[model samples]
Target chain A: MSDIPADLRYTKSHEWVRTEEDGSLTIGITAHAQELLGDLVFVETPEIGAVFAPGDDCTVVESVKAASDVYCPVSGEVTEINEALEDSPQIINEDAYGAGWLFKLQPSDAPEMDELMDADAYQAHVDEEDH
Target chain B: MGNKTPLYAAHVEFDGKMVDFGGWDMPLHYGSQVDEHHVVRQDAGMFDVSHMTVVDLRGAGAKAFLSNLLANDIARLKDAGKAMYSCMLQDDGGVIDDLIVYYMTDDWYRMVVNAATRVKDMAWINKQSAAFDVEVTERPELAMIAVQGPSARERAVPLLPEDLREPSSALKPFFAAENGEWFVGRTGYTGEDGFEVVMPEASAASFWKALFDAGVKPCGLGARDTLRLEAGMNLYGSDMDETISPLEAGLNWTVAWEPAERDFIGRKAIEAQKAEGKARKFVGLILQGRGVIRNHQAVNVGDETGEVTSGGFSPTLQASIAFARVPATIGDECTVDIRGKGVPAKVVRPPFVRNGKSCID
Candidate 1:
C-alpha cells in the first residue's frame, strides 16, 4: 500500500502523470511499480523531442534482479527527463514520484488526461493486480 | 504458500519479499539486494540455504559407489572431513546435478545437492545404489545456513557449540568439522571467507536470530545470485543440466582426468567429446556498451552464435557480467544481442570478482 496522491492521474500500466501549470505533463512510475521492481541498477529514459503514441514503451528500468518497461500513457512529445537518474538510478527506489520522475511531455492531445484513471481507480487497479 | 523452510517465519518477520523458487516460497530480498550483496562482500551476511538437499551415505561400498557416480574423482578426498565439488552425470555424459560431497570416514560421506534436482538425483542415486551395498538417506530434518564475508568467521565463532567453537573458527577452506548433529564447513559460493553451518531444523530460527543479533545481515536469493555470479560459480539448472556436459559449462577443471583406469560415469562420452575438439567453451562476458546482460541472450562471434547461460549486473564491478557458452573459436570480442539490437561486449575469463576485489582489468 504505497502512497497514491489524489491529485495525480494514472494509467493501468502504472505510470502516474501530474499536470504542470505550463500545460506540460510530468510522468513517472508509481510507487507501487518501484516497489515491485526492487532496487534499480540502471534507468534508460526516452530522449527529449521524441514523439510517442499512448502505450508505447518509453523507459526501461533495470533492477538488480530484472528489467522492466515503462509505457508512455499519453500521446506527447518528450520535453524533459530526469537526468539525475542516469548515474543514480537508486533515486527511483528512494522517491519514486518526486525526484525520480522519468520524463516530462508536451501533450499533443488534451483529452488523454480524461481517459486516464483517477487515483482511487488506479489504487483499485493495483489491488486487483496484487490479488 | 509453498514449501516452507524452518526460517520462513523469520523471513516474514524481517520483511523479506517472498517469491516461488522451484516450488519453494523463498525470499528474493530483505529490502535492497545490492545492499545485501555489499554487506556480504565487506562484512558479514547470512543466508538460509536450507532448501538444498542434504544426504548421508554409509556402507562398505560407499567410496567405490561415489567414485563411479560423480564426474570428479572422489578418491582424491582421502583425508577425513575433506570436501569436493562435483557433478553427477547421466550415463549419456550430460550433467544430472552439481553437488558438494564431504568425506567423514571410510564408510560415511555427506552430500549437498541442488533443491530443484532433488527428486531426480535421489532416484538416480537410489537406482545406482542397488548394485552396491550403500544405503542412501536424505537428511530432510537438517537446515543449512551460510555465513559469508571477510568477517563471517569471526562473528559466527562465538555462537558455535562450546567444544567445537575453536576448531570451527580455525577450519580450513574446503573442509568440514562435526559436533554431534551440527556440521560446519569452510566453503561457500560467494567467493569469500565463510562458514556454511548445518544444524538440526528445530534450531534454525534461533541460530538465525543469534546471527542477526551479531550484526550479520540477512540476505536472500537475489543477493546470493549476484554474489555467486561475480564469483564465477554456476547455478545448477542455468549453467548446466541433464542435456549439457560439464566440459561445456566452465567446469572442466572439476573433472579429474588422471588415474586413467578409474572409470566414472560419462567418462567415455566426455573423453569422446574432448577428442573431437568441437566442444563449446564457457566464458564470462562484460558488457562494453549500455544495457544489462540477461540469461538466454544471443552472443554473436563472427557468424557463430552462442547462448548466455547465466547473466546479471555485478554490484562489485558496477557493470554487467554473464556466463556465456560460446564456440571454441570465439575471440576476445563478441556482440551480445540485447533486446533487438546487437550490443558489443568483451570476453574475459569467468570470475569478475573474488575476496572483495575485482578480478577483471
Candidate 2:
C-alpha cells in the first residue's frame, strides 16, 4: 500500500493536499491516480497566478494511453507550479505525496478542507470504487 | 462476470487494476505502467498474453490451405521450426487480421491471431479449408506467456526443463520448437529479445509462478502498447481494420507475391490497387515541439490531410511519436493537431526506438 500521511486530505478524483504554515496548500496527485495513469508523458498545469473555482480543471496529466484533467479540490489562486516535473514527470509515480506535488495555491478558504475526505474515508472510497 | 486468465487471481493479489479487454477481465497495470515498460526495456518482464487465441491447423493439406487463405505464401517456411508473419485478408484486399503462422510440420501449422478477430478468423479459415482438407482446431485449453527484454533470454533459458534447453537455446528469431507439451518461440511484439511460451492450461499457473519466482516482473496491457509502438509493430484494430488495407497500414512487406501463378484470396484486388496506385503511405512522425500525440488526430501535409493510427509519448525518446497514414504525396514535414493547435513534426520511418537505442537520426 502507498503511504498516506494522516495530515493530508484527499479529493474523490485522487488529489492530495497538505496545508502549509502560511495557510497556502500544496497539491499533488494521489498514489492511486499515478498508478491508474501508468507512465506520465506530459503535464499541463495552470499559470502561477491563475485563479480557479471549485472543481475547475487546474491541471492535466497525460500517460501513454490516455490524458486526464486534474480538478481543483477547492477554489484557489495558483502560487507555484512544480518546476522539476518539466524534465522529470515520472516523479509523480515515485513520490506522489511529497516531491511529486504539482502546485501550491492560496486557498480562498481553508474551511473547504472540511468537505474533503480523511485517510479512512478516502481508503473506503477507493475500496468502493474497486468493485 | 467476465473471463479471466490463469493469472487473474495473481493480478488481484498484486493489486492489478483490472479492466474489460475484449470480453476478458485482464490487468491494465500493476500499480505502475511506466515502471513495467522500463522493466521490459532494462531487464526482463512477463505479460499474460493468454487472451490471444492459439489455433492448431492440421491435416494433409494444411500448407496448401494456408497458402491460399493467407496473403503470405506458407511454402517459404520449409524448415520445421520456422515462422512467418502474415495477414489474413478479405476479398476486397482489406486486412482482416495480422497473425503469425508457425510451421511445426507439413501436416500442422499453428496460428496465433488477435483476440477480437478470433471468431471471424475461425469461420473464414474453416470455410476456406473445406476444399484443401485442413482442420482448424482452437486451443482454448492453452495459455501463453510472453517474456521479453534485453536480458530475457538469459533469464528464461535457465528456467526451462533440462530436456528442452539445447533445442530451445538453438532456436533462432521467429522460430519455435516443442519439447513435449511446451512450445517456445523466439518471436515477440516488443523490440527486444525474448520467448513466447505456450503450455497446457493446467500447467500455466505453475509455469507463470516459476517465472515469477525466477524474477520476471509481471506486466500488463499498458506497457505492451508502448513497447509495440516503439518497436513499429501495429495493433490490428487501431492500425488496420476491415476498412483498411494492409498495403496502406505499413504491412505490405508481410505479403508475399512469389510463384507468379499462385493466387491468394486478395491477390487480384491488391494487384488492381497496385495498378491504380496506393493512395496513402504510412509513416512515423516525431513531434518537433512540446505536446502529446494521440490516435485519430489530424496530420496536415500541405494540401492533403492524414490521420494518426497509433501515437503516444515514447518514454525512451522522451518525445512524442506517431504512426500516421497520409497521402502518398505527403512529404517529410507535417503538422499534428494537438488539442486545438497544430504542432510541427518530422516524418521518419518507424521503429522510433529499437533495442533500447534511438532510431531517429
The numbered model that scores best in lDDT is 1
Residue pairs of candidate 2 with colliding backbone atoms? none
Which parts of model 2 are misplaced by more than 4 Å? A1-6, A108-128
User: What interface RMSD does each of the candidate structures achieve?
Assistant: 0.8, 1.5
lDDT of 1 by residue, A45-87 (tens): 9999999999999999999878999999999999999999988
Query: For candidate 2, what is the lDDT?
Result: 0.88
Predicted complexes: DockQ each = 0.79, 0.59
Q: Write the per-residue lDDT of candidate 2 for residues B159-268, one digit (tens) a residue.
A: 77777778889999999989757899999998988999988777777777888888899999888998899889999999998888788999988888888788999999
Candidate 1 regions off by >4 Å?
Answer: none
Look at candidate 2 and tell me the lDDT of residue B283: 94
